[model samples]
Target: MSEVKLVAIFAENKTGQLAAITQALAQAGVNIRWVAIASSEAFGVVKVLVNEPDPACEVLRAKGFMFSLLEVLAIAVEDQPGGLDAVVKTLARNKINLRNASGFVAHGRAVLLIEVESAAKARRILAKKQLHILTQEEVMEF
Candidate 1:
């Protein structure tokens, strides 16, 4: 499991916007690990987990893109039935709210990146349940 920093950029919902942003990151030599985009009628928010978030932020800021930095949880769970269900159910039982979640399976492990209201509480809950929680250094090493 690994914990990575994500730089979420907000931009206008217009043509060439996403391309320009991606180009900036590419030119800066930043590698994107995972990404998600949500759009409204007027604007869009692009959430990107990258190897170099600080530099990526500088790139986007120079391009005049509004952005934010968020610390999130990246956990590796068993790639089997009930893997996600177990975590979700546990959080639900503890009344922990999940803001956003995304994941994929690779090499028989389900890697989940989630944003919750409280990282400490979430980590505590997961630890109490004996689940593995990723650290920032671990994520960067990957």
Candidate 2:
């Protein structure tokens, strides 16, 4: 799988927090590709994959939003049973520990963004199996 940039925004779980974040990004014209929100009572963590992560980061930074950039692998898998199994098994066999992951289906494909111990090794292993790894541009296509 190839590496993609993910932006993490830490904000209060109260109202207007996400509004301000999205508004700033929208004002800067950052096209958000995919977004996931994880929350408890106090705070929420918003992870986003955008068309241009670097520009998004700069825009949010200037807006005074608390955020960070993360390197995540975008892997395109089959939209059928055993599809995820094949990918995860490959990484597991290679001694790569999966720390966190998120997935979504679009264009009839199951796209998974994974955080692992060794992205390079995971890419090599998937490459040998002829799996498709998404680039930044490709991710936007979805």
Candidate 3:
């Protein structure tokens, strides 16, 4: 499947909050593949892709952290400028509104991870355009 699970941990904007989260995950032996932190004045969302999401979620629960599992598309883009724009344009043309998006380069591949209103439909549209979508195992390999 092209859908990959992302762990979105909601945290307060305080010192050492990130460290605590990572520490807990490390203690639980969860390998984080990618992570992004976005914050406002008082709160933040820590999004992460991990090697083992189910166990990671359990660890977060045991640690009293509030988080959710989000299914997102991992699209393979060109590892160059405009690579992301190209995918965005295609989605825009199809009237697919992206809820969230981020990118990373790993294993010599440029990946665009995105959350949309309808993942299945979006996948179909992107597939028609010849965009490569990463499978679950493929994403973990990175």
Candidate 4:
């Protein structure tokens, strides 16, 4: 099991904000694997999983956007009913708090990137349940 650092960038709620950020990544040669965005009238937060989180953070920071880095678990689970529920239930049983989660399916498998209370513990828990936790290189391959 391995953990990857996710970069969440907060930008003003206006046109061209997301484009500028993405352009920066593109110019820097960073490959984005997964992304999610949430917003309100005031601002927006973009959560991104990329090949180079540190460099991504630097690029965004250099552009004057507010951002933070977080450690998240990227687990590959069976793509079937109850797969997500089983993982959630297991975390609940262990009193692990999940701050956020996002995922997508590829080749009949579900890859979930979750922000939990403890990365190590979460990895151990998932491993005990026979789940494949992805490393940075593995995630990039997806």
Candidate 5:
């Protein structure tokens, strides 16, 4: 149940925004492990998990980008039908509210990134049910 940090950027939904942000990080030698972008007609939020959070943040700040660090949970789920559904239902039944979620498949397993109201509580609840919660090191290795 270690802490995982996600770098969230608030930017306008226009050309070059994402590129600029990513380019700055890249130039600083920050390796991005995962990224999710959600946008509306006017603005967007770019969330990323990088190898070096501090360096990435510094690069973003030096580049004049508005962003924040978000603590999130990375859970390991089975790569099959009903795997994600079961986890969501368990959290809902336990009174855990899911704020944001994104996932990806790697090495034949599904990694679910969830933003919850109480990450520690959610982690305990999930663990009690035998769900595998990935550690920060495990996530970074991906």
Candidate 6:
């Protein structure tokens, strides 16, 4: 899989938190490509893979939002039954443990952003299986 720099945004896990973040990004002209949220009562983390990571980061920083960057793998799979299973099974066979994963389907393809024990090794294994690993440029195109 290709390497990607994903943004981890920390915010309050209450009403209007997401809206405020979205509005700030909108005003900054940044577009969110894919997003996932992990939350509890006190706070929340919004993991966003945006079209322009730099601008998104800048906007968030300007607004005094606490955030961090993550290096992850982006995998492209067929949008069909068992497609995800095929990719995951390969990792399992190699004993690669997944930390977390999130995906979205558009343009008839499913893109899975994964954090695993070793992304490089995972990429090698997936390549041998003929699975498609999405490059950062490829993701921006989507």
Winning candidate number (lDDT): 3
Instruction: Give the worst 10-residue stretch by lDDT in candidate 3.
Output: 1-10
Order of models, best lDDT first: 3, 5, 6, 2, 4, 1
Model 4 earns a TM-score of 0.89
Q: Scored by Cα lDDT, where does model 1 land? A: 0.84
Q: Which stretches of candidate 2 lie over 4 Å from their true place?
A: none
Candidate 6 clashing pairs? none
Q: Report the C-alpha lDDT of model 3 over 3-36, residue by residue, as the tens digit.
A: 6999999999999999999999999999999999
Please give, for residues 33-104, the per-residue lDDT of candidate 4 as tens digits. Answer: 888998998898998889988788788888788899888898887899988988899899999999888889
Backbone atom clashes (below 3 Å) for every candidate: 0, 0, 0, 0, 0, 0
What are the per-residue Cα lDDT tens digits for candidate 6 across 32-57? Answer: 88888888889989888888888888
Model 5, 13-120: lDDT tens digits are: 889988998899999999999999988899999999998788999989998899999999898899999999989999999989899998989888899999998988
The residue ranges of model 3 lying beyond 4 angstroms of the native Cα positions read: none
Span of ten consecutive residues with least summed lDDT in model 2: 1-10
What C-alpha lDDT do the candidate models reach, one value each?
0.84, 0.86, 0.91, 0.86, 0.90, 0.87
Q: TM-score for candidate 5, please give it.
A: 0.91
Backbone steric clashes in candidate 2, count? 0
Best candidate, TM-score-wise? 3
Q: List TM-score per model, in order.
A: 0.91, 0.88, 0.92, 0.89, 0.91, 0.90
Clashing pairs in 5: none
**Which of the predicted structures, 1 or 6, would earn the higher TM-score when compared with the native?**
1
What does the lDDT read for residue 133 in candidate 1?
Answer: 77
